[model samples]
Target: MDAFIGAYLGVLTLPNVSDLDGELLIHVGVGRTVGIWRARHPGDARALFLFRSELGYHHHGVPRQKELLRGAFAGMHAHAHRWVYELDRTPAFYFDSITQLRMDRTSLG
Candidate 1:
């Protein structure tokens, strides 16, 4: 592997997350990206990327971030928007569930 991206939030559940080669991706700011693969597949669970901290505090203190995330996947399948209070503290990560996201410590500032 290139290097284990720290799971500051958690681990990746989706097997193909590391290889978004043929998927259509969307820039979600904060230097993060969301590859839309199974956005709204009827009964399938929707997936999106996140900055570990955003997933950790989605309901605690980031409403605007939540709104932006929701807006990003509004008609599709985004859960919420993630914003940071400390820009320098933000870490690169991907959301797999509501409680946590797949984190990469090496990608952090």
Candidate 2:
């Protein structure tokens, strides 16, 4: 597995997080790759590869991320963008284009 993917998998294995309200949302940004992962089954966590866009590359803008993710999800669905691995069933992980990039280390074990 890729280094980032391995890191994400490791993060998912840590005990159950109570604040997710029955869902797990993960956001990752590495160079041109930025994505959010949702874990439907607590144990079904998996990494997803997302396409990056240079046209809109702002960081941490919740609204922009939401819009971009919504549009990306829609476009992906239309284009049959299916993940090879099982991920969260809910679609809550959104990418914003204009928000500050906070280093959330709480999720890292």
Number of the top TM-score candidate: 2
lDDT on C-alpha atoms for all candidate structures: 0.35, 0.35
Model 2 regions lying over 4 Å from their true place: 1-49, 78-109
Residues 1-109 of candidate 1: C-alpha lDDT, one tens digit per residue:
2323322221112323324444554545443444434323232222354433333333333445434444433343242222221122333323332433454565755
C-alpha displacement of 105 in model 1, angstroms? 20
Q: TM-score, each model? A: 0.25, 0.30
TM-score (C-alpha) between model 1 and the true structure = 0.25
- lDDT (Cα, tens digit) per residue for candidate 2, span 6-87: 1111111122222334443433344223223435666343333354455545445545543444444443332122331112
